[model samples]
Target: MMLTNAVLCLLIGYVGSHGRQEMFSVLVCIQTVVFVCCETVLYDAGLYRWQLFIITCVIAAYTFQRLHLSKKLPLRLSCFCMSLYLSKATIVLIEHFVFHPNKVPVYSYVTILFLVFMIIRIFVTEFDTNAHSFTGHLGLLCVSVIVNANPLIYVLSSYIFMTESAASDIAGLCSMVCGVLIIIAQSIHVPEDLRVRYTGVLGIFLGLVFIVFRPNLTPTLYSVFQWIEVFSVISFVIVMVTDSVTQFLQIMLCSAVLGLCPGFRAAIMLYPEDNIPVSGVLLFMLSSCIITCIILCFIKAQHLKHTFEKRFIKMSTMLAVVSMVAVISDISTRENHQMFLTLPSLKLILCANLVISICLKLLALRQIGELLPLTEPKDDKEVPYLPTIGNIATFISFVMICLMAPTSSFYHDVWCCGASLVLVCLQKDMRIFSSLREDNQTTATKITSLVILVTATLYRSDIWNYNSSWMFARGVTEIILVLFSIPNCYILWGLLYDNVLVLNEQIVIFTLPLNFPLILYSSSYTGWALAAAGIVSSIWMMFAKFALQPYHDDY
Candidate 1:
């Protein structure tokens, strides 16, 4: 009964909320919370079979009516919803009579049926039918199914054979990279208006990598070198193919597989545990539903039919082969499970770098979208300073990274913060000063400030051994110094560059102030309040500088 409610909620939330993906996400989160709470309560009370049937019927009826009455909803969607509800209700009835069970099994045939319906709904409602032939659609469907099923197949095959070999890992990684590269290559062929939307592909890929891949320093370094070699060859070859619809089909197949693989893996992993953990199950459902919806939304939003060159497909194939062989050779000769758990700091650094890269890419995509004439301001002096969806997303990603860093850190808080500040200052100043003929007052000021910051960072051990009064004052001074210097450096950098900080950098600049309350007072509430203030102030600054008054003639 609980699973049925989850399915109904997922469908209604997805199909009923047109042009409101955020609302759908919220609905899913709320429904999952409510259902989990209710189920926990009901489990203790011992839900009866009759009670389950009654509940399923009521939920099913409500879902059917809700979907049916949505005026803008397609007729096919209505039918699909009805069929899904009826199927669930039928499964409950059969369980009542034959199995005499209180609830359907989580991994039962009914669940498989629900997944099939969900996938078909995604394909029918989200796929661009006018963009490709029937054969193309079928090919994509097959690829999605295979990709989704791959995890389960591997798990099952493990019982019969050794499925966890380096060879298999290499093959899987090669396949994943091939799919990603193909999608990126295909994005080049999409209409200009729709091209920016493909940037979300990077987000999807990074999100999956975060969830599924465990980083190791050695393999990562090796993979990078191999990827560069393969990328160069593929780029040369893909530039030579003729543009055609068939190539588009191949690209679509790769996109579908890449987009759906994460969700499918999450869902499949849900089946293995002997006891169902409510929190785990709820989280899995939420993430999977959200990913699927986001991907579908991207697909449905594109209207133009674009064809890719045939060389893209050939290049993708050759790249896959090359990557596979390279990975296999690298992995095969190495001792099993060696270096897997080594270099914990390296892994954290890699993950942090990946997050920053994705955020930056998202920012770039937002800039591209903003450049479109439709979104461009009519007045030369006016710029759009209001935060867009992309800006909000980038901010959220940045904040998450900031919050996550402290938890993952291996060094002292003070040293870590100081080092980060120094790095940011140096990185920005080096770039700004590189083209300058000689150091000016501004440059001299920054260099001196950096030296002071570095001296304070290195004096951490000495400060700790001082008398309590002196130690407290010194700590406060250091915190004040960092809080001051970090923003000053960024502001100076921004002024020197004659450009506003990008959303991600703005996040860094603003949130740097939180170190005061966070380190000196150790108050989370204070930290949060300062962070919120910083964000709001950053937005207001952007609005004031660009929207209210012209920052520059060209801008």
Candidate 2:
């Protein structure tokens, strides 16, 4: 497993250093050989932190040494270091939260590989290989360094305590302070006065330093503060880079937002009887505030307004409702891992607040998306592939967020798929309501919609148990969600057929119900009626698309 991670890290570094697609297959072969050799010779050895660190350092060296490594060596090295630190941080996080120390298994290896692969893929893809903007690279470097410094800060603090080395402690402190100043400097836009920026930065640095190094603080509290600091730094970085909020930046920023959600879940540890070190209420409040602010800033960003749609609002609302319901259900049934005593009214209020907040922000997003553009770029340059890639990544992140919601009811599955279908509708210019504008339709489109609607109606009785009634409801929800995808399927196909997109419609169409599991759970009849209405509306919409097809000819 260690060797596999090592090889994977190396492959990722190689790819990052050389941003060409042609040599990707060759790198794959190298990874395979490294994996096979390591398995053959080092299978009996235990993985060690020192070994991983050494391998990372070696890769960093090699990455810096490569051809066409056009970026400044220091800058590239810093990025690689941050990437490696993030990868290690990921493994440490998984070990602490997801897996037991003594239970290192094959599945753990697979998960580690997947995590490393994703982090690497994101870094390599989002990185401006051409180095188009100096400030952009600097911003990324600064953010990564600030995030990467947390672990080091902890390690150095521990070392200072253990070794009683005043010199070492002072050196480390100075370096971190310098790092913070650099971040602030990079974060400033052109003509932005450095005096004001540094003043703000100095204030931020003092607060963070105080929180981090405050005496008598518990380990758990310290960790929480560290995360808060990182979250703030990320927010600052995003704001700084708003001018260049390209697809890569958007996706990176969104992914960071999603990654921070679980940290907010730590609020569950606040119960007195839980024996958790921190105040759960404080944790939850801090997390909620941070998350709300972050979401608001992200959705309201001037650069990202064009990328969102009405369906995104619907998707966010549905996911939030499902999550809230799942949490409430778990608490009511005493199925929650956190044994905190929560009142039903309190739960309902929390649930409603979360849903309403998300919906309101999403509504703002939709409004922004609909607003007229100031001016399209006159340069004949095509839109980059990065935006589409970012959209897909954001959708994946949404799916993961939905799946993370703890729920025993089939509502979780139903809503997750429903949200994903909404994502399909939101892609590019395609919208849930955009079918109203399209005048052209084919006979095949009508037939396809008819088949889907009838098939869903007919399968309800056989697949879902009527005695339970929720099964029927689940069936209807599935039907409605699929039916919603019917017109979207045509929209996506039209885009593909028109050469607006290089990919086929099936990519988005097939994923409509991909997360929806085969089994159904019992629930209320409300889902059924809603889903039935949705199905009927979807059928009507499909017919409308066909009926209105000829109207455009006269205009």
Best by TM-score: 1
For all candidates in order, the CA lDDT equals: 0.40, 0.43
TM-score on alpha carbons, each prediction = 0.27, 0.25
Instruction: For each candidate in turn, give its C-alpha RMSD to the true structure in angstroms.
Output: 30.1, 29.0
Q: Summarize candidate 2's per-residue lDDT along 1-555 as a digit string, tens digits.
A: 555758676776787567554455345445544543453344234443535544654564355334224543334333344344445445444445545543444444434444334334333434433334534544444344344343333444555566433432443454455455444443533224454355446545544444444323245875565556555555545545455443434544553554343334444432334343333343344334434433544444445444433323433444344445545544554434644324222342343334344433344345454463322343555543322332443444444445454563444444444444323322332332224222322322333333433343444433356555666676566555545544544554454234243344334434434323222321333334334433443344445432333334555
Give the CA lDDT, 0 to 100, for residue 108 in model 1: 48
**Candidate 1 whole-model C-alpha lDDT, 0 to 1:** 0.40
lDDT of 1 by residue, 412-527 (tens): 33333333322221111222333432232244333333444334343442245656876666666655544643564455456434445533344444554554543444222333
Candidate 1 lDDT for residue 553: 71
Task: Report the number of backbone clashes for model 1.
Answer: 0
